[model samples]
Target: MYSHWARFAVFVFCLTAPLSIAIAESDTGKNNPANLVGHGGPIKAIAISGDGKTVLTGSFDYSAILWQLDNTTTNKLARRYSEHEGAINTVTFIGQNSRFLSAGDDGGVYLWDRASDNLLMQFKGHQAKVLSLAVSDDGKLAASASWDRTVRLWDLDNLKPLAILKGHKGPVNAVLISGAGQQVYSGSYDGSIIKWSVKTGRQERPLYLHGWGINVMKWLPGKQQILFGTVNGDVQIFDLKADSIAKVLIPHQRPVLALAVSGDGKFLASGGGDGLIRVWNTADWSVVEELNLSFGPVWSMVFSADNKKIYYTGLDDYAVAWKISPRKIGQEVQGKFPRRFQKLQNMSLGERQFARKCSICHTLKAGDQNRAGPSLFKIFGRPAGTLKGYKYSPGLLKSKIVWNEKTIDQLFAIGPQHVTPGSKMPLQKISEKNKRQALIRFLKANTQ
Candidate 1:
C-alpha cells in the first residue's frame, strides 16, 4: 500500500495603497507575481471564476478566501470565510460566479453568495468528510462525493438535497456531473467508478475498475471521455462510448493526486505526490510544460480563464501560478525553499524530532498564528484550548486539561484522540519513550 504520502504564509498588506505596491512589499524572497500567499495553512482546493477576475481557495486552516485577480495588477486577498469547523477539502464557483460552494472535513457543504460574502445555506447530510464537488453545466445541480460512501446530489436553486446516489462500496473520492445534468459519476477507494442516474439515484452501470484507488477525476470536453488520476500514478482517459481506456499517461513516479483541464478544453494538467506537474495539449495529448515544484505534493489545480496560466495549491500555504504559454514554458520557478521544517546539518535529535512531528502544524514562536495549530510558545503551563484567537473544539474546551510536563507527556503517550476525544488534533502517537522524551525536551526548550 502507499504509506508514504504524508498529509501535507500569511501576508499582510495595506488596503488603500496601490495593489502592485502591496504585493511588492509583502512578496519578498520566494513570493512572486504567480503566487497568491495569504492562507494560514496548506491550500487544499482552488477555483477560478469564469471571467478569471476572481479566485477562491480553501485551506486546512478551515477557511476559504476570495481573491481579486486582474490583468493590470497583482492578485489581492479580498475576503476570508472561516465558518467551517474543519479543514476545507473542495471549493467551486456555482451559478455563474454569483455564488459558490465549499465542502470540508466537517461534512458540511456550504453555499455562499459571492457578492455579499455571506453564507446562503449549509447542505448537511454526509456522515464523513466531503472530498470532491462538481456542478452541472447549466448550474442547476451539484454533486458532492464523500467518505460516507455516497454522492449527494443537490438542487442548487432550492438549496436542498435532490438525491443521495449511494452505490459506491467504499469511500467516494471523486464525483462528476455530466454536461446535461442527467448522470453522475463517482470514483471510490474501492477502485470502481459507478455511473448513476441523477434524477432517480439509481445505478446506471459500472464505468471502469482499476487496481489502485482513484484520487481525482474530470470530465473531458464533449463528455464522451473522462480523465482520471489514480493513487498508483496512472493518468488515463476512459472513452465513455467504448467503455475502455483510451490513453494512458505515466507522468509521475508517485501517486497522482490532482487533474485539471483548461476552460477551453485545449489543455490538461496533472500533479502528483512527487511535486511535479505536467501540462498536456489535449489535441495531441503532448506534454507542453512540466514543473518541478521542489516543495510538496499538489492537492488542487485550475487553469486561468485565458488558459495561459495554471493556478495550483500544494503543501505550501499559497496558490502558485505557472505560465504555460509557449513563451514562458521552461522558466524555472524560483524561491520556495529554506522551508521552516527542513532539516539542517548538526541539528539536535530533539530538534529533528520536532521538525518531523510537530513543526508543520505548531510553531514555536508567539505572534505566528499562521499555521493550522495554535502557537506552542510558552506552552509549558498553558491550559488546553485557551489560546486567544485560536478556535478550539468544544470537546477540548470541556476537557479542562492544563499543559504541563505530565500532561504533555501523556498527550503523546496516549495520543490526542485518547487524551482529548473529538479534538481537531490529528491522530499521533510517540510509542518510543526516548523519542517522546526528546520531543518533550525540544518543546520545553523552544516553547519558552
Candidate 2:
C-alpha cells in the first residue's frame, strides 16, 4: 500500500542526493523512505543474470561488483570487477550465464567472460557516454543508446557493428528488447519510442509510446503488458488486453531510472532518481511494497528469476540486493485492536511501529519465538503475574498487578524497577506518553 508519509520521505531523500535527474516529472508521487538502506555511496545501476545466480552493478567510481545473491557466499565467492576506465552505466549477463556486457562513460562497450576473468572484447565506437543498453534473448545482438544521440547495434558473435539506428534529434535515454526476441524499443529525447527489427537491422515500429521521450519500457515476465518507467516518474502499463495503455502508475517522486518486471510478471519494480524502489501489484496497479535505499539514484534494476530477490544500482557506484520472494505474510486477526483505534490506518501505523520497536524483545503473535522477553499477544485482561515455563521477578510475582491499560502504562513509563523494585526487567522508563499509550492500547486490544 502507498503511504503518503512514506512517499514524503522519498521526496526529501531525492532532494538531498538525487538518484537521477529525470525525477522532475513525478505526478502520482507516492514514495516511501522507511525502506532506506543506510550506506555511503548511492547505487547507479544493478542487474541480475538470467539464472538469478549472479548480480552485477556499475557506479560513479568507474567500477562494478558482482554478488552471488543468496546466503551461499563468502569472501572468495564475491569479488569486485574493475575493468572500466570510467563510470560504468549499464551491464548485462550474456546467454546461459556465460559472459557479461558493460557500457559506460568511456563511450565504449566491454565484454567479459568470468570464466577467464579477462576482457573478452571492447567496442570503442560511441562518441558519447552510453546511457542505456539491451541484449536479445538469444544473446546474438546488442543495442546501446548514447548521449551522442544515436542507437548502435552490435553483433555479439564477432563483436562487430551491425548498424546504427538514428533519427532522434537528442540523446537516446533508454532501450529495451521485447519478449518476442524480435524487436528493439528505444526511447529518446525526441519524445518518442522507435522499434527496430533485430533480424534485418531495420526499423520495425517507429514514433510510438509516450508523448515525451520514453525513459524505459520493461516486458513483464508472464504477460504482454509492457510497463514503462518514464522521466516523469509515471510507470505506464501497456496491456495487450486493452490493446493500449491499461494503467498509468505514477508513485515515485522523481524520474524513474529503471523498470523491472518480476520474473513471474506478477509485480513491477521501479527505481530511479528517487532512491526508492516501488513495487506495484500487477492486478490492481497499487503499490504493495516500497524498499528504500540510503543514497544515489537507481540507474537500473533487475529481479531474480524466481522473484525471490531484487537488485538495484545508484550513481554512487554501489549495488544492493533485497529479498522479495516467498513473500512475508503477517498474521492478522479480528478484534485485536482497540475500538477507539477507529482509524484502521492508524492501527496499521501503530502495528508497524510496534513491530519495529518491540518484536525483538517480545512475541506479539503466535509462531514468533520469544527472545529475551515474554509473549504479549494475549497479555491484556489477564493477571500479569506469570506464564508457564517462564521466569518472573519476585517483586512482580508479589505485586500481583493485573494487565490493563493503566497498569501497562505505568509499568512502561514509570519502569518496572519503580513499580516492582526487585523485578528482573533490564530497562528504563519510556519517555513519550503517546508511544507508550499506543503500545498499551495495542497490547490490550490484542489480548482477547
What TM-score does candidate 2 reach?
Answer: 0.60
Per-residue CA lDDT of candidate 2, range 83-155, in tens? 5555567777778878888887678888888887788888877887787778878888888888787888888
Which candidate comes out best when scored by lDDT? Answer: 1
Q: Where does model 2 exceed 4 Å of error?
A: 1-14, 17-42, 72-77, 207-209, 239-243, 292-296, 315-317, 324-448
Root-mean-square deviation (CA) per prediction:
6.9, 18.6
Q: List the residue pairs that clash in candidate 1.
A: none
lDDT, residue 444, model 2: 61
Q: Sum up the clashes in candidate 1.
A: 0
* Number of the predicted model whose TM-score against the real structure is largest: 1
What's the residue-level lDDT of 270 in candidate 1?
Answer: 95
